[model samples]
Target: MIKSTQQSDNERWDGEGGSQIAELAKSLAIEELEEADRRILAFLGASVLCLWDELPDDARQKVLNRELVQSSFDASVVRARIALLFK
Candidate 1:
């Protein structure tokens, strides 16, 4: 049925996206980190995640409002940067 086909397509797309994210994470990981550096990176990553998780509802709403105001200009600049890189 059409529904089953759509579900399978979605699952395939999700799998591909997940693999791409995993590959990016692998590429971003520090290749030659010392134990101390690795511990520092882990601590920083955990702290960032915790800080994000602890953001207040009003702060999040403000961020969303600011993003909405800036997104179009930001996106246009990003597109221009990408275009320059390709040129």
Candidate 2:
């Protein structure tokens, strides 16, 4: 019973994370892509997703956490540049 519960929890987490990733990818496609680029980007995104899924859970978590930090830093840098331009 406990094992079944753990499996369900993992499935729920995976489903939620997958949906979030898909939504973000779709939003990026809408915002920045031309129609011609969409197919190529979608193919690349699928390939990356497959690779991501093959990673061990711990490795995937580490990579994602590091990416979050890097993304935060990048956003801050961009914001600072924009502020400088305005000033």
Candidate 3:
């Protein structure tokens, strides 16, 4: 499906928020990912807000483990992990 272009939140909303977190998630310096990846990451972040506690312990650990991997990571892998994270 096509993504929305309109403002999604008050004050700030452009999917760059996820890029900022992805930037901060690293121990060493890293460049921002493409906007699509950032948008996916932002959705992941948002999903975690609502779904984290609802997941079983094993599933949660599996996801957290995936997220703890290297910064030069694949967005698809991260997306899969996020999907599994909340499943």
**Candidate number achieving the greatest TM-score relative to the actual structure:** 3
lDDT sort, best first: 2, 3, 1
Model 3 Cα shift for residue 1 (angstroms): 46
lDDT-best of 1 and 3: 3
lDDT of 3 by residue, 1-87 (tens): 123423444225335354445454674222345566567677766887689789898876555453454544665665566567567
Over 1-87, each residue of candidate 2 has an lDDT whose tens digit, in order, gives 999999999889777675565444444324344554455545655776789878789877764453463445443454454457557
Q: Which TM-score value belongs to model 2?
A: 0.38
Where does candidate 3 stray beyond 4 Å? 1-24, 27-32, 66-68, 75-87
lDDT of 1 by residue, 62-85 (tens): 533533534443434544544575
Worst 10 residues of 2 by lDDT: 24-33
The per-residue C-alpha lDDT of model 2 at residue 34 equals: 50
**Model 2, stretches more than 4 Å misplaced?**
1-16, 26-32, 53-87
lDDT of 1 at 11: 85
What value of lDDT does candidate 1 attain over all alpha carbons? 0.56
User: What is the Cα-based TM-score of model 3?
Assistant: 0.43
Which ranking of candidates, highest TM-score first? 3, 2, 1
TM-score of each: 0.36, 0.38, 0.43
lDDT for model 2, please: 0.57
Ten contiguous residues with the weakest lDDT in model 3: 1-10
Instruction: RMSD for all candidates, in order, please.
Output: 13.6, 10.4, 10.2
Report clash pairs, candidate 3: none
